[model samples]
Target: MTAYLTVVEAAEHLNTSVRFVRRLVAERRIAFHKVGAHVRIAVVDLDAFVQAGRVEAITDDRVRRDLSGAA
Candidate 1:
């Protein structure tokens, strides 16, 4: 069974504030479930949300040089 987390738990997992997690739900930014008037977030959904925001490091020498204002 997939684990479900409450707003507070989700916040703790994400190292953020409960208000931020609530805001995410309110803004429909993160996937959540409503169970009997309670909001729950699946661990998978949370992981997916974090993955969606993943930004790979810039490793290209040219790109790094350009960004560094080096010729």
Candidate 2:
């Protein structure tokens, strides 16, 4: 079953302040749902948001290219 979390729950899960989560909602950076007067975020959406922010390590070839002025 999919999990739906409140803003406070999402903040706790992300180990961030509730205000930060609210900011995300305000910025529409993360997907959220409106239930009447409440806001909820899907666990998957939160995970996807985190994944979208991931930064992969640069490869050695890319580093070499940059160093050689090939970029």
Candidate 3:
């Protein structure tokens, strides 16, 4: 079953402040739902949001090649 979380719960899960989570909702940066005057976020949506910001690590060979070109 999909889990729905409150703002505070989302913040805790993200290890961020409640205000930050609220800002995301305010800016519509993250998907959310309104249920009878309450805001809720889905675990899947939150996971997607986190994944969207993921940056792949560069290998040492690529870094060396770029640095070599600077010489």
Candidate 4:
């Protein structure tokens, strides 16, 4: 049996807000199961989502310059 977590629990586990978790579900960025009106997220799926969406630290001078409007 796969362990599932409620949106609130998942958000807490991820150290994020419940709203953010809901947005992820609404945006289809994270995989989830709906049991009635409740959203359940599998632990594995959550980990996978985090791994897939992990962003590297931004240290590119060119990119920073463009972002800072310092062309």
Candidate 5:
């Protein structure tokens, strides 16, 4: 069976604040479920959310070799 987490748990797992999670729910940005007036977020959904927001930084490191403040 898949695991489901509460708003608090979701926030903790994401290392963010509950307000942020609540805001996402309010903004309809995150997948969630309603169970008897309680909110639940699937673990997969949380993982997906994180993966979706992942960013890869690409930088060229061959143009910087300044070890002194003399230009």
Candidate 6:
């Protein structure tokens, strides 16, 4: 069975604030369901959203190399 999560749970899982999660939902950037007055996110949807925004962390050396010629 698929699991559903509350806004706070989703934010914790995303390592972001609840406001940002709500903004994503409000902007239609992520999918969610409204149950009465509460918003619920599907685990799969949250995973997909996270994957879509995934970025690799850059080391100091990499940053210097990338910005070598920048003024």
Name the top TM-score candidate: 3
Candidate 3 local distance difference test against the native: 0.97
**Clash pairs, model 4 backbone:** none
Query: Which residue ranges in model 1 land beyond 4 Å of their true spot?
Result: 61-71
lDDT of 3 by residue, 1-71 (tens): 98999999999999999999999999999999999999999999999999999997899987998889964
Off by over 4 Å in 5: 59-71
Q: What RMSD value applies to candidate 3? A: 3.3
Residue-by-residue lDDT tens digits, candidate 1, 1-71: 99999999999999999999999999999999999999999999999999999997877997989999999
Give the per-residue lDDT of model 2 (tens digit) for 5-68: 9999999999999999999999999999999999999999999999999998999998999999
State the C-alpha lDDT per candidate. 0.97, 0.97, 0.97, 0.93, 0.90, 0.93
Off by over 4 Å in 3: 64-71
> Model 4: per-residue lDDT, tens digit, 2-47?
9999999999989999999999999999999989988899999999
Ranking by lDDT: 3, 2, 1, 6, 4, 5
Better of 1 and 5 by TM-score: 1
TM-score of each: 0.83, 0.83, 0.84, 0.73, 0.80, 0.72
Worst 10 residues of 1 by lDDT: 55-64
User: Candidate 3: minimum summed lDDT over ten consecutive residues — where?
Assistant: 62-71
Query: Considering only N, C-alpha and C atoms within 3 Å, which residue pairs clash in candidate 6?
Result: none
